[model samples]
Target chain A: MAKSRVLVVGTGGIGTMAAYALEKGGLAEATAVMRSNYDAAIKNGIDIDSVQWGQVKAWRPTAITKNVPDVSKGDVAPFDYILVTTKNIPDVPPTVADIISPAVTPGKTAIVLSQNGINIEKPLIARFPTTPVISSVAYTGATETAHAKIYNDDPDCQKIGAFTSPQVPAATAAEAAKRYVNIYNPTGTLDVLYDADVAKVRWRKIAYNGSMNPIASILRMDTPRMRMSRHIIDDLIIPIILEVRAIAEASGVTLQSDLVDVVIHQDPSDTGFKPSMCQDLEKGNLMEIENLVGEPVREAERLGVPAPTLKIVYGILKGLQLRVKEEKGLWEAKFQSGNSYE
Target chain B: MAKSRVLVVGTGGIGTMAAYALEKGGLAEATAVMRSNYDAAIKNGIDIDSVQWGQVKAWRPTAITKNVPDVSKGDVAPFDYILVTTKNIPDVPPTVADIISPAVTPGKTAIVLSQNGINIEKPLIARFPTTPVISSVAYTGATETAHAKIYNDDPDCQKIGAFTSPQVPAATAAEAAKRYVNIYNPTGTLDVLYDADVAKVRWRKIAYNGSMNPIASILRMDTPRMRMSRHIIDDLIIPIILEVRAIAEASGVTLQSDLVDVVIHQDPSDTGFKPSMCQDLEKGNLMEIENLVGEPVREAERLGVPAPTLKIVYGILKGLQLRVKEEKGLWEAKFQSGNSYE
Candidate 1:
């Protein structure tokens, strides 16, 4: 069998780690798409110090390209899987799907959404209806501390399954999921499992992302400080978890009963782990607000589930995003019906 | 008759303006209690650049005392009124009422709470049972841009009313309210009017402080930017105002039907006004969260009013306060049960 061809969209920590894993599996050739760190990555490769894979000095993928469209120009085979590991900020233009659309081959290329958010695959599925879409949830702790320097302390583990639609049949979607899992986990030590119901896993993951991420961002607190605040844990965090759980249940996904407590104690009490949203706010970067909080809030509204906590939280996150946009000169006042406040 | 003797507790902008106004009226002898600004105030008095009263330099009160106990040490008659113009942060030790208790003569001194908050008079009234309590809301644009330098742009206006209690009769409370309005507005040009129902005024004021103040602090946006964000005004601010109105109604305070609209448009849309709480958060100072949002939330709970907005806003404000406290090294981890996330 010919070796599978894989394209990685974002060259952040996750993308770099995923490319390394696919290349180490020996069944796939990984081409990393680098934008900002292209010079450093092409010259020095990537220096990774990970707990799972220790002391990887200057690891480089099979191929490197500056743009996505450049990949499909020459005589090249179709990419079997294109993993999008970018931040899921949907409000900004040229979304992840749009950026990766140029390289996707309809009905051939399976797109994997390896990001932190719910409803992240909708845009890709809408753009390429016949293409097999894979929904994935990653549980690795990977970060690029400096240019081309990656630090991944946590183990590499992820759950991926097919996102079926009318255009893609269930069997085909399942086959695509199984093929990508096998290609990405040839050593079987990467813990890349094929989940039958990815939506359930997404909802279960949202029980934390939808609650803790935004709360920590709003409060500018890490996990340990948040856990130390009794009033916050009981009043704000728990109620928000219940709201997310209620919305999940209304959408036909029943989260575990003790899910609230589990989410609270998921991390150890002393871990000073800051959520991505909190870090984004601190760094004045755009956050994954729309997919992580906004979409679920709209879903709750549509499902008639009372999500007061979600609404207030989404409103706050939106306001914070506006501040970031204003600082970056990206905010435009869109007026409607003669009201400026809108 | 001799001029009425008054001691102003806080020498901030409001207190300074109050002293200036009282002395300008020539009906009260004002003594300002200064802490950090005591040296500057005593040596140079205060520099004023005002839109109402243009360019009055080095304006000093009758007497400047460093401490409250020192004011009552000499062979001086008891103070007729003790104006507690301090920030109303009750959660911190040695509250405003406690600090001013040494100079307060029970049944002789009228305690004035010229501060921003709802239910501020409760503490003072509790400290002095027979003493008349006055609740005053300030509506002036004043800020101390530098040490001993004051800037007052807007006209000085306030509403003075008696906070009646079981120990103080309505007639006596009414007399105290009338006497305060008279003394505070001797020129009759300063818009200090007597309000018969002071609780109604407080609830009306809270429709703004309890909503806009905290929301702006959380979002870090001024009035203009907040008014520009339609989502914030329509989704967050308006909903919070409605919640406050509901809580007020449950407490038998019939706020005006157009109170919400009035609160929204009270400030012009183009003005860049930052509320006190917003300023406090930016300057890393203790905010008036306990009285401004906490008390109203407790009231909503007590009256069976569904105030989800208030509850969530209060929780966020508490978390922010914790951040400030931690920065100042004032937070204590009080463990109750087994869980620390409390």
Candidate 2:
């Protein structure tokens, strides 16, 4: 059997980690594709620190920058599996589609989405009707320090499976899963569950993120504080979780347990974690507001369910996002005015 | 006519400023009441900075602590006007009622509430149905420094009126207002509007405070930055103002202009303009949540109006309140635990 050639899109913290893991597993020849020329340069020269498997020996995989690799140059092969690990922002889906669409030949290509949240899968399917796109739920606490370091606090396994229609061969999906398991084997923590009902897992994770991330971010306080404070748990967090659960149920996703219990009660002191939402705010990056909280909230409204608590949290987070944009604009204006004065 | 003897409760910033103003204008003979027993000691050796009127000549009012001036003192005359400028918390009403209720004679005694928020009036009326209670709005900003210094910024005028039902005698209310104007002949400006629709004015101030204070407090950002930044204004501030207006309209309190205009478009360079709500948060004082936003929102609900914006702002503020409490508890716990360990 020929070794599967895997193309990992996005070379951020998660993308780099996944690529490194795949290379280490020896199941496939992995190529890391980044969006920027600077990113490509950094990947080639910079050493990526791995929290799970010590640094990957300064290993440099075949790196590409542009979305459509030059097929005439005969430098790239069609990918057996394309793992998309981009952040769920507006430009991500289109960018992924542009980059991976050419390489996704029918029956041979399996596109796995390892980002947080749902709804992105349908769009990918719409863009590439024949490509087998597997929607995976990734639960890990990881942060990239500089270009080189990826720190994973949770080290919990990643779960991958087909979440939508366009039935790909079960063998192909299994091969992709096997490749992931082998790559993540050294960490010995990758438990990739292939469920026909991937929506449940996605919804469950959404419930957790929806409840914990926004509340933690808006409060500008820690998770332990929220968990210990019954006031927050009862008044704000629980109600938000319930709201998310309602939306999930309406969308045919059954949540098993309360998200508040899972997130808040977990010993947050061990992680000293700030949610990605907070990171986005601090970095002045556009938050995953629409996909995570806003979309579900809209869905809840459409389904005639009152998501009062979720709406409040979403409003606050959205407000924070706008504030960030305004501040950035002011900064840019000030910069321009100073330049003019100069 | 004999000069009206007034007991000015709460010798903090507002109380001292009002006393100084009253004394300067010859509105009434005023006595300053302090909750602490060191009143005379602090008074005997006066700190010029502590006086609200800055350096003053003569006309030092009598200073009595709670224990020494227990209402039953024989020489104490029935207070014609009791100006209560205490912090507006849950305990304020009952505390004032306990100390001043005995001296409040029907038709003669008038309690001028110089506190923030509109909720206190209802409780005061409920407690002492016969004693006349007038709601007065003060625009002059004052801060108490050291023992005797009270600094008044620019404005010298206070708006006084009979705002609620079972209306006090028009003549008595006018008499009280005249005395207040005379005593506090504030240098900058003075206006006494005797409209029965004073709730409109109260609501207007509430609208401004409700919009600016909590956000300023939570963000710990200056008013100028908040006002100038579109992100802050459009996202956090505008939504809050809109909510406040909705609640005010729903509660039948007509507002002047819109809150957004007053809060966001108001000039950034205004002086002595920290949100009083932010001041409360800094002091770890119980915020006037019930009166400023909560009560009005509850009223809106009662009136079958949905105040979605107000509901979210109120919830966020409540979360902050709870978080602050939890943080304090944690700090206290750690302190105690350290002491035990030592």
Candidate 3:
């Protein structure tokens, strides 16, 4: 029997990790689409420093190309899974749907969204109408350590769920999710669970991401440092999770009670990994402040819920994002401290 | 008759401005306690670039001394008013009471607490129980432009209130407040209102301070830049004020509805001045994170009230404060960004 073939889009930490996962699962073949890093990825392959995947000095795939047309050679094999692993930043060139849409076959291709935050798969579902969409709640603390090498800390089970938004029908989503699950969990490489309630799973993961990601960025500290300061985390990190819990509750998504511990319970080894938001700011890349912090906070506010902490965190992240943009000569956004405290 | 002598302690922006106010009022002889810039003050007097008091190239006070022991002459005549204008930081040396206790007489001297946030006069009240205290809510947007020269944005009014905390009896406080009002309001140097409920007045000012002060410092922005972005202030600034209002209300101190608007309306001149927190971080001086953000947020939390916005801002400011302290050879309070956002 021919092995199931998958296409990985955007070669950041997530894309590289997914490609590696596909190879390690040993039941599928992986092809990646890289634009700027195409030559480097093809030449150097993809080096990853992860506890789960060990050290792969050079990870060369069966096939690696830039655009959709050249993703797979010959008579269009129709990719079974198109896994997107790019940063969900707003207002940048080359959106997810735009890059991954052309390659997806009407009935054969299923877009596996391995992204953070909620209400993300809607755009792909909207753009690809008939394509089955599965949301991946990636729980690993991961980052691209070097140009092509990726680092994973606190490697945990990846949660797969049928994204049943208003756009996608339940039956269709469940069927696609099952197929994706079969591919994701063959040898139990980072045990991927198929959650029927994807929204809830996404919300639960957000409780961790929204709190730790932006905070680590703003404070310029990692998970270990957060663990080191009891008061800072207890006083700060936990409260942010509580706010997110409030947001989820307001949105009528009942998150699990142990969700807050997602932030508190961490492997000290993962302490070395920087969150994606901090990486975005440092690399002068645009951030996903809206998706991670702003959107959920807005949802809570819309429901007349008090989410002051989330809102302020969103503001700071957005401010930093704007600062990065201004530095890049994209736009002009300036402010002063007004000596108001004095 | 020799004029009533006032001693302005901790010569920053507020100290410099108060000295100018006293000199312009003409009812009292103003003396300053300047340790770091004693020579500068003695040599150059106090140069002020204020909207209220035009520009004073050289305005010498009656006396400029360093310590509390030498505040007054051999007559042992206590200061008519020892207006403290220092940042109310925690876990630091020379607290409010310790710094001004030596110069305060039992019945004669009134220590005007020109500070922001709640319950700040407690220490002074504890140390000098019999000495009357007046709480001043200074509304001007001012900065210490030079060593002694201060730049004032809105030199409108400094609300004088009789502090009736547990240690202060209302009658004694009222009488002292009246005297301070006489000194503060002579020739209408600044509109000094004698608020019978000083706690309420202080709480209202916290609505403004807790929102703008730490935020300005974190973002390194002034008031005018805050005005440029409506959403940033609306989404960020107003919510923080609302949180403070919740804190105040939870503490049974009702804040005015218009308190949030205090941050919205700004004099353009205030744009250039750096807030005290920003100035502190820039100059590597210690911040008042505890008094301004921590204490109030803790008060709210203790009362089963949610003040998440205040707490996170406090965390960031404290982190910055810790960074500054570590840099200054003070102590080990360090954390790296870990490139988490990357």
By summed lDDT, which 10 consecutive residues of candidate 2 chain B come out lowest? B333-342
DockQ for every prediction shown: 0.49, 0.16, 0.22
Report per-candidate TM-score of chain A alone. Answer: 0.95, 0.82, 0.85
Q: Give the DockQ-based CAPRI class for model 1.
A: acceptable
Q: Kindly report the docking quality category of candidate 3.
A: incorrect
- For candidate 3, the per-residue lDDT at A163 reads 78
Error of 2 at A216 (Å): 1.2
TM-score of chain B of each: 0.95, 0.81, 0.86
Instruction: Score candidate 1 by lDDT.
Output: 0.86
At residue A94, candidate 3 shows an lDDT of 70
- TM-scores for every predicted model: 0.96, 0.74, 0.81
Poorest lDDT segment (10 consecutive residues) of candidate 2 chain A: A333-342
- Compute the lDDT of residue B26 as modeled in candidate 3: 73
**Number of the predicted model whose DockQ against the real structure is largest:** 1
- Report the error of model 2 at residue B257, Å: 7.7
Candidate 1 lDDT tens digits, B78-100? 89899988888888888887799
